[model samples]
Target: MTHHASDIPDSFLAKWQTTTNVLAGIFDVPAGLIMRVLPGQIEVLVSSHSEGNPYEADEKAQLNTGLYCETVMATRALLHVPHALEDTHWEHNPDVALNMVSYLGVPLLWPDKEVFGTICVLDSKKRNYQDKYVELLWEIKKSIERDFVVIEQQRQLLENNAELQAALQRLTALQDELLRSEKLAALGAVVAGISHELNTPIGNSLLAASTLQCHAADFAVDMKQGLTRSRMLDFVSTVEQGAGILMRSLDQAAKLVGSFKQVVDDQSAADRRRFDLGEMVRSVLSELNHTIQGSGHRVHCAIAPGILLDSYPQQLAQVMTHLVSNAVQHAFLPGVAGTVRIAAQPDSEGQVVLTVRDDGLGIPQANLGRVFDPFFTTRLGRGGSGLGLHIVYKLVTAALHGSVEASSEPGQGACFTVVLPLSAPAPLQKPEVRAVRNGNFV
Candidate 1:
């Protein structure tokens, strides 16, 4: 009853035409029709081109007492009024007015028993219809219902396919975002380390410059008071010393700044180059001197001088910075004197072994294993983003194609050891970025 004639394929409609026409001719009926039922009316779906046929396709009729389909739909069974003219109720029906006094029909059904329509034959004169006529119409009804089943299943499959494609697109988007977040986290850590390293040399240079200016002003005043050989000699010595201090401080700052620029350039390009390991380590230590300037902590380096490597120096610099900074922040309490030692040498296996050891409050044994995990920090809400060690681990293993290990016991301090090939195996890909705050990858 809910079927749309336009939704039925032309091939299926052609088949329906053949079936209805055959049934009409075999029965010698005036009309053979398939009607689709609506809420309050019936419409002709297919009408046979039989002689004297009165019904046309798409013709609408009310579901009243006179209609043959109305009776078939209500009964949900065969309706065979062989002699409607003899029946009192049918004598005044609309079919009788149309000269269709005899009818044979059966209700068509969907699989769930919902009525689809009715298939029937109408004749102008009274005649008895055999049981075979009803059975043939029922077979055609079953065939029509099978086509509806195929359509419904196809619709469901199309819906499922669309949903699957949408889900895959969402997953790809999430993966892209995750890769970007990781790159940003690495970049943030580098910026933080550079900021801390620059503070010391720049601070010392500014102080020395200010002192030198004061000494020059005093020398100017002394000269105006008249010449005295002893005073002049003392003033000259003071002025020379002040100038030396200022120049030395500024030079140290300039060296640190040069190191920073080279490291940044190498990291951004991710290229392999020749570098002296000992000098690089010393430069990094110089930048970090401010961290231990007044904390009573001492830094010791035993790097083998002239030890050179063809590798990514910037990545190595970053790893060293993280290790040293971690010691300053976590290895010791404020004002507590401790020792952080860096040692590097070549191994017999063509690899370089670098160790950063700290004598402070050592890591708890239970926490040592998880130190390199991203966002895993013991100092949450107290200045730990927990990504420093994670970045180190990633660089050593992924970018440098190297290996690292950490060993510690509570109150005995912690030590990190790294072993990398003299030359990197391949150039690293661009880093995916994520947000970082206080050293935590977010």
Candidate 2:
């Protein structure tokens, strides 16, 4: 990692300052310094508190100026100048002007083998530093390198956490989008079913009306020719029969339309209201009638009456729709008959237990626990998006503040039970993703 002088914490710098002060006292030098390497410059990061030390902390000098610390950094090795005035090569170096003739310094390197700077002692008089002194400086260099390792690790950890957070946000966005699409798809299917169902009654009414129109015109023509008593009686009987058929057909159509309108309004608006549990379930089942009939499955609702709830009716309807739809789509085989039963009852704890059970092929034991997971479907490419149960799980737990569980016995049937409070809690600002264990949310 690239680092700057300012990146060094003050705590570490304080420790280095103490080290420099001790070194200066031991060496009896005028200056004991820890330098940091920068672009085209070298800085005195820590300077000793020894009396008469010329270099102060944070002092900078241009690099490649024949400075003793610069040479140590360039070679990444030790440089010991016993006497600068005595050596012709260093006689005109910058330290000579400061009257510092003797130098002993070691290069400091980071864990990545990059230059940090140098640690050294400078004496005003010529002195030959001992081997023990050089070894002690090398020990201090090792300690500083260890500090570099810790800093780099912390930097990498922070970067990794940021990346994980970003990925989680992205996953949440995609899940929301998929959830919306699934709802639209479900709504569209209901519309198609209702349209198909409306065809029969509307067609019957039209046929009856047309037949009555022809009979009325024939009666008028017969009236001009002096109609007989038996003919007039037949005309009155025909009119009565036609009127009854029209009333029944129109009444049936109106009922279907009313049920459709209520279900659609509740689901689309998603408004919270007090409603009868049995009535709501019947409405939802009415909308899903076409789907159940198409699958050759019979639905028997045994919901108790007078069980009212103050909650989001739309979300509850969705839960019912998906659960019933799941049973119809997965429970039976081709040309095989099955029964899906919905039952609900109110408990003493002001809660309701709603169940959807199918008497068809049951879920396998191994796959039972993972049925609620998103994008997990046995019928992958055969018209299953796999979000059906997942959405149901989210709605019950997060929005409705309830719990759902799935149970099955192989070759018998599958059952989904949902327990919800009579009054739902306040809605959350955002849906929470929860873990499911053993086919139930804990």
Candidate 3:
């Protein structure tokens, strides 16, 4: 909070000294000085040399009633006396004792309005300082203040950089935690769906087995009472019916288990291999069949077969699953019949465009843009975690090195198009340079 002119750097002192030399030469004064305000004294930080120059650099003077600098500091104004001996009030000033009777000075101020000192010139003979001289001194003072401005700016910049770094650190930690929470939530939802789907088929198979056991006991009793031809025929028909039910139930259970296992395995595995895009899409549909089972919505795929990719198939599978699931949950109203169509093809640019479109109550025009933003959902309190589209966006961009966008019109339908390369770009590496011994380096 407390600043003295002595606190100025040596570089600034050197510059001020050069300025004082120029000022004195222009004004043809015997001495020019840059004085600094200390606790109780005015100290000369720089002095200009001319013939008969009585003041030297680093000379100290008291700021009492008799000195011209004292008057400038007291009023915070310029003090100009053509000749101290001619002015009745300044005839006995301390400078008069050194035979320097003329004086011109202006008060210097720090950025905070605190007194720094005075910039002044003195003459051994009677001489007046012109307006041009005063103007020149003002310019020199401005140069010194400019340096102070730079110092303050650098200080604030350092402080702001520290705050920015701290904020970035906090954001990184939150992002990690959010990623963990989203994974757990997605896993929980998948497990619940798989459980629900397996329950029906397995439960039906158990019921049919119980019934078959009861029928067998009834036949044993009828045999002990001496079996009839009609009874025997009826028992054979009943046995055939029960066996058919058991077979269908068990078969359904096995198919559900296989589909669920395949989806879970693909999502967890990150292996990259050659795969057919059309087949991959159909596999994803099988896994999501349970989601749209009774929702009156059907998924149709028109992927170009033999369109192979050497990318992360599992991640692509997850992307397809989310796209279809989003359509089932958000594109249609309850009990409404609609069709979700997925089409994939290679474009002229060697990029594959996969589009998932729906014919249902489409998204509102206003919400189309924000649908991919994290935690942005119209069904917040319902079953929406609001992370599905956000996850899709990230996977397509970061993991797949692709881009995705959505377009929708209310009541017309919504479509999400993902554009990806058949193979991601290779990572950058430093180039190798070989020296050729023949004639020149290559």
Candidate 4:
């Protein structure tokens, strides 16, 4: 596993302890040990329970010393000293103090081929270990190395799992940020459209007031010069006509301003209330009139009147806005005129089936299933954020407690149908108050 000597698990330690005890009994030795190699030292990690064993568990000794296990580790092979006292090299070794002269050991290694330590048996009398016993120790060494492989695999899995979780969290945050930006952009478009619509009526009112002022000044001069009955009658006619024009123009301007304010409030506050579906639909279409006309497209609303809904009007309006905008953007090519129709009706189940259909280039069969997927847009890099329809799906299904689907045939047209309950389910908690800051949601 390429780990330090101190990283041994308790389970592996228990297994190694059993191995050491068995080896001591099989070899009929006083001491059987599993040693671990540390930096500049060697540790007795496991020791046999046999009587008269000199070595104890956790006993440490300085490295570079003439010990039997050190010779096995340094040579990366088996070592045997049949009679340490009679040998010229290992006679005065560290274990000689305990009268452990004979020794046999095999080097142990990690999965990466790094030194771990050694497994060995020591006795106080001179004796030679058979070749079969040496082979047995080697087999045990291989078993420990296999355990190291399993540990490394488990560590890698844990690391990979943590990384995946981090990536998922980052993706979620980015999606939220993009959704906020889309909402703010939609609201901005509505504001721009309303401003453009107000210009015509307000301009007409201003012109009418200026004309009336000029007419009154001319009448005063004529009256001072001795006005006739015919001239006074003519002046009266002009005054009546100017007054009518002023009233109509001012009234139209006021209505547009009022509608704009209502839409803005509904979208910003997201308050739940009972509202007429037909009227709400008309207002949303009116707010988007500029974008529709600018694209040479038309939107027709045939929503069933008196079909009321007790739901978040803001969320429903957002759904409508995105649906209509999606049609205007994707349902036709540039400068191509098209028709988008919105219809609604109440079903027997106390639900409303609202649809937005466009008679333009319909969606292809292959892409029909993926139209509502986030960031799935055919018009990449041409002002298509790919989130318009995705936002619609979210609002309908989540906030409004509804179901929505898309259907289309190539060159026929595309339709988005949403079925929503008349009375939405109560929210689990209050919604957050949202505001726009620097063209983004805050």
Candidate 5:
């Protein structure tokens, strides 16, 4: 509807003008018009003719008027004719009698659930207003519907974006909570292992102390009165036993503490170092021997003997340990054990390929993309924090300057390949940093 073009946006009013010109060419008609029907008036939104269109702007065609748009709106019916002048009920209007004759008009529904206007094509001479012409008007109505669908789609997309943002915030909160829970679980495992390590030495020391005290007192009494061979022998034996117990306890304590220190140092923020990759794998396997065996799993370590890397050894070990542990716990379906393969190979360009694969039921394709996402875990309750793979990815990409890729097919298996430098080759260490441009996706 329009009084002056300035009332609506220039772009909006201009759009209808273009539509009228384009539709006139496509329909092969003298004129094409779009009208907005109001409470007591009809307004022309479009009129393509340069000489001024026969369809008037702001002229209300009264209910019983013979004009096509007015009569069609009044009766809520379609009106099409070969010649408006020949139709007894329609040629009464001066506009039709003067020159405009053939006509086709159809309702332009408000798609917003309100009734709005009519879309029509007009010709000045007698022409065939066949059923195909009526069908042509219906097609134009559909094009109008297409525009409304686009608007509705954009509205729904914005609403979905809002919902997704809320979901992402909730996921971040859950990740913090999971980190706390993981810390506690790891702490408990450390405490349990330490207790077992300390018990064996402490118990032996207690027995040795008791025996040494009893034997020394007897030996001292015997020496004060008169020397005795049997008593001296007993004193020597007690001293030897006590010495062995003290040495054993010291040795066990030192080894346990050393391992704990190594774990801590590996995670420290320090310059990278070169280390033997093969030895690292062996050491991790030895430490987790009981766990592997208890779960009916075997450790297979064949890491090419002397492959070296200029990265943190302890961190790499942690990643491998977590992966192997994940395989043991979650690789297979319930009540089944699967072989977990771990291999490392070097290429010509000083790049190292480390592949870890499992012969167990694989991840679903829809979920494969999300597996490495922080806090995403298929095994939720059965001891999975979902951060192991996330940590692995971070270490490989930033710390080691490497790339990781994963592939899988349902019911087949999953494989994760990590490609890194054979040797960072004396390069200076640098901190990881990133810059954002138009959007911050990462």
Candidate 6:
């Protein structure tokens, strides 16, 4: 029968031998055997010294201890048998055919609070069993129990250590994910800054190109009509103007390229220094003069003298570009032009507020809050990465330690205001972009 010791972590078959010869002599048997009851099986640990047939170790015998150990364990009784062949409790056992006649078995209750098995003695001759010999077996059972407890405790300790190791692995994975998120946020902010810095010079070049193109078209007409000396000189003048335009455009372009290059290099390099905010914004807007005129929109700017920031300039450029471009692209529609005002002024407290105002189709109140969310774009598929405002938010909050807000009404136009801290922003542990942008119905 299945028993607790067979499956219990603390249970095991132990040989408690205290002079087997003396044990056999005292028990008046040929063999002194110890068998432990385990779950679904039994283990034979010790066998007595015999003169006749030696009982080999059981390799495949289930404790198959029917009601026997149960009765003795429940009652704590000593089993005394004169002859196994005639005993009603064990006559059916195959051991009866062997020279075994006397069977005295006692349940071993160890002192350490575990049941190792049962101790028994078998004799070829039928002999009356006694209590004194059974009492000696109990003493031996108690001794082995002490050792079992020590070993079992160690096994439990090992299991606990293994569990702790698994928990540490899980914790490490979570920490890695957190680190990755932080890096991605930083990357978004840098992109925003770079976008801002590029807008100005490119805009200036575009204006210069347009002015030269208009002048060249006039000279082209004169050349096509006739090759007069006056026309030739006029053509030369036109060529010189175009060359100057090209040179200016190229120079502005070089500055933009250099700025972008430094930003890219910083990704694989070390820390960068702060930049002049007022200068960067002013330089960028100079290039956009032509675009403003082409779109029939006027730009009114009031940049503070010493507005400055401590951060990667490229990322800050991106933030400004997205905001300004958004104002340009969506500022005017339906034969109606608008005014875009860019102002930067430091308050008495030294905090700088940059405002971009557009008098075009103002944002709807409902959608104003969601524009900055990643992948949330009102433009459908029209060159909108849905990342514009998202990138802006990331830069302002993460890199600049600044806050941005917008207010608008239908037909009244919209205004975006960003407030930057006077000093360098403290690094944040978990920087995330805020959602902004929506439709305003008039």
User: lDDT by residue for model 6 over 343-434, one digit each (tens)?
Assistant: 88778876788898888888888879767555455654343435567666766766666778878888878888988776645554333312
What lDDT, from 0 to 1, does candidate 1 have? 0.77
Please provide TM-scores, in order, for all candidate models, with all chains considered together: 0.47, 0.60, 0.54, 0.60, 0.43, 0.44
Residue lDDT tens for model 3, 299-396 = 99989799888777877887898889888888887767889999988988878999999998888888787677544567644545455676676657
How badly does each model clash, as a count of residue pairs? 11, 0, 0, 0, 1, 32
Residue 413's lDDT in candidate 2: 97
Give lDDT tens digits, candidate 1, residues 82-200: 87889987788788888999998888776557787888999999888667766777887778778767765765697799999999999999987975676576456645654554555
Which regions in candidate 1 have their CA more than 4 angstroms from the true location? 1-6, 64-66, 166-442
Better of 2 and 5 by TM-score: 2
Q: In candidate 4, list every pair of residues with a backbone clash.
A: none
**Between prediction 1 and prediction 2, which has the larger lDDT?**
2
Q: Which residue runs does candidate 2 get wrong by more than 4 Å?
A: 1-22, 25-31, 48-59, 64-66, 83-101, 180-223, 226-256, 263-442
Error of 1 at 139 (Å): 1.8
Who is ahead in lDDT, 1 or 5?
A: 1
Residue pairs with colliding backbones in model 2 are none
Full-model lDDT for every candidate: 0.77, 0.82, 0.76, 0.81, 0.67, 0.64
Residue 339 lDDT (model 5): 79
Greater-TM-score candidate between 2 and 3? 2
Give the candidates in order of TM-score, highest first. 2, 4, 3, 1, 6, 5
Candidate with the greatest lDDT versus the true structure: 2
Best-to-worst order by lDDT is 2, 4, 1, 3, 5, 6
The residue-by-residue lDDT of candidate 2 on 159-218, one tens digit each, is 899999999999999997886676466546545555656777799999999999999999
Off by over 4 Å in 3: 1-22, 36-38, 43-68, 75-102, 106-116, 124-271, 286-294, 334-336, 345-350, 364-412, 424-442
Cα error, residue 373 of model 4, in Å, equals: 13
Instruction: Name the candidate that leads on TM-score.
Output: 2
